[model samples]
Target: MPREAAPSDPQDLAILVIDEDEIRASIIEEGLREAGHQRVAVLADMRNLLARIEALAPDVIVIDLANPNRDLVEHLSHVSRAVSRPVAMFVDQSDAGVMEAAISAGVSAYVVDGLRKDRVKAILDMAVARFQAYSHLREELESTRRALEDRKLIDRAKAILMKLRGLGEEEAYHLMRRTAMRENRRMGEIARSIVSTANLITGDEE
Candidate 1:
């Protein structure tokens, strides 16, 4: 996290790291800390990446590009347009050369509206560093989320099964897990399906 020179509200300023390289990520995180940014979150695995970004309401977003992901570009485009935040990219229209330099360094930065160029450039060095860090964090977080979500879905599915089948918790969970595996789907997917079906059965949709 980068510490603020003057204390800013947590809602006022935040930075998110979205890189996948551990070593490079650390360097960026530490650099931001040294640069006086304290409100930072490293996103390792971003399951609902865009939603998380929206919830955090960060002042800036730094993404690490190992290769481009459609989800990322789409999210960025949506954020840049729909949300009040500023989404920076290395397009030929806006400072193409600087964007080129940044891409060469393996990072890109986006800030919210009303940030002056001079102020942004003042933090450019740190922004570049944080972009790499955030990317690494995003990958790690995503992995953790997958593991955690899997367990949660299993538990929820088990509860649903027990309620519906008058079976023990263990047996119910096992049934759902086996079904998920056989179907080549995630436990959450199965759980969601069960919920939807139940909703329909109970006439909750209307």
Candidate 2:
């Protein structure tokens, strides 16, 4: 079992190494320490990889494979999808298909035959930067999708209110807003509830 260091800046991020080979794991660990990262853990037994990783909760992950088969690569992909942390994978051989699979698995850095002690820090840095960039894009896309859905729900709710109460669009919107304020809830939430109830009541007609 490896010990963790005290919390520090981003440059000193805690790292997790998943390698069956002890020698290779040591080289990667040494390189990280040389680069100013003091918190590094190496895991050889992968019986419960994801569970162990969750327990450790490292900031980044490094997987070193000497010669991986298709199944092994696919397993790593599953691991990558489970964890949102930055992942750097090092392999001895290169194959276009394998590289593509690794990228699809959310690996930030996929190095082929480039696992040099001198280059570990730079590779880790690049992985972290790429992961952060991708995470930001995902967040923005999700927020935009939510906003569009809210707008649609509000429109549906407004139309229902207008038809039921014989009010104009503006009046319907203001009524929903005032109701939301009085109930201490978001307008979108109120709109969604109204739309759902209206749909349920009209289900038999449809």
Candidate 3:
């Protein structure tokens, strides 16, 4: 844990270390403390780990294992995916299969035979940075997907209006925009409503 002399919130840049080995955990914890991290915790096992992590509200997680088994790797992967926090996993030895599983489970940084007291802070920084970049990318992708879906809805609504009310595409779109602005709702919402009502009136599943 990096510590500053000033008071700090537990949830602010808080770090949680998961390691069964006390010696390794102490080394990492000491490195973080030396680096001025104020809020850091260490757990020895995975028993009720999710509830424990929820209570701690860690910003990032460090998982260290000397010899991880299949069950343990799976369990850690579940934890990695369940929480949105960045995870940095370190192991003394690993295979391609284990590494692939960790990557798929969303481990931000996976290190093998690279854990040292001096390297802890750097690894943590990299983990957090990578996670932030990935999260931003995912958000952008989601926004683009929503925009496409909204466009589809708007076009379908416009088509329905043109067919039912003898309106042109421009007219249908303007009607939707005016209704959206009047009601303080998004254009997508108005378009969806129009499409839904038209479907009901025509009894068409399409």
Candidate 4:
């Protein structure tokens, strides 16, 4: 099923503007307010950025870096990795490598020389869309990984049951299923318990 689109109304979103320069932060703040965003906060200092962000709990983050040094860029990368909020980074200039790094860091929007009040709303919208898409993909990937692990555990459990109980593969699987149903637990949980017990018993025998 197609995921629902993120809310487009700026009024509904809490925005955080991070910039070392007060003027630049004001510019971004003004842009957001003009776009009908009422819940906007600006931070000039970068110290304890993660902590501040945690306290603010903004839905979207706008970072303006006039001339980002290597350390600053790295800090932004860390924020990108740590924070799941939609991020729109505005930079004066950037090289190809830096752009690639920003994308790798999970930045939703990397705008170069695009810091106009009129453009802020559109950029924010784009950022939110990209963030949502990436989030969905990450969730799907994690779920697939977990499902594969569960299948492996179930297979190992089935093998143990077949050997220990002298039961056929189908019978072993049915036994686990019945146990899961009786306990109102997941099949994977039952499978994992069986595998763990079998390993423990085998180790003791040795």
lDDT of each: 0.65, 0.63, 0.61, 0.62
Q: Total clashes, candidate 3?
A: 7
Please report how far candidate 3 places residue 8 from its true position, in Å: 32
User: Worst ten-residue run, lDDT, model 1?
Assistant: 2-11
Q: Write the per-residue lDDT of candidate 2 for residues 1-206, one digit (tens) a residue.
A: 33355334644555777767565566667767777677788777767666686677665566643423323434444555665432335432443554454455344333222234334446555434444455576789998988898899999999999999999999999999999999999888999999889988989332
Residue 61 error, candidate 1, Å: 0.7
Highest-TM-score candidate: 1
Best by lDDT: 1
Ten residues in sequence with the least summed lDDT for candidate 4: 105-114
Candidate 4 lDDT over 119-200, as tens digits, reads 4446455434444455576789999998998899999999999999999999999999999999999899999999888878
Ten-residue region with minimum lDDT total, candidate 3: 108-117
> Model 1 has how many clashing residue pairs?
26
Give the CA lDDT, 0 to 100, for residue 15 in model 1.
70
Cα deviation at 140, candidate 1, in Å, is 24
lDDT of 3 by residue, 127-173 (tens): 34444455566689999998998999999999988998999999989
Model 4, which residues run further than 4 Å from truth? 1-118, 204-206
Q: Provide the global lDDT of candidate 2 against the true structure.
A: 0.63
Model 1: per-residue Cα lDDT over 81-156, one tens digit each: 6665546542434566667656776777676655456445535556565564666677899989987876776676
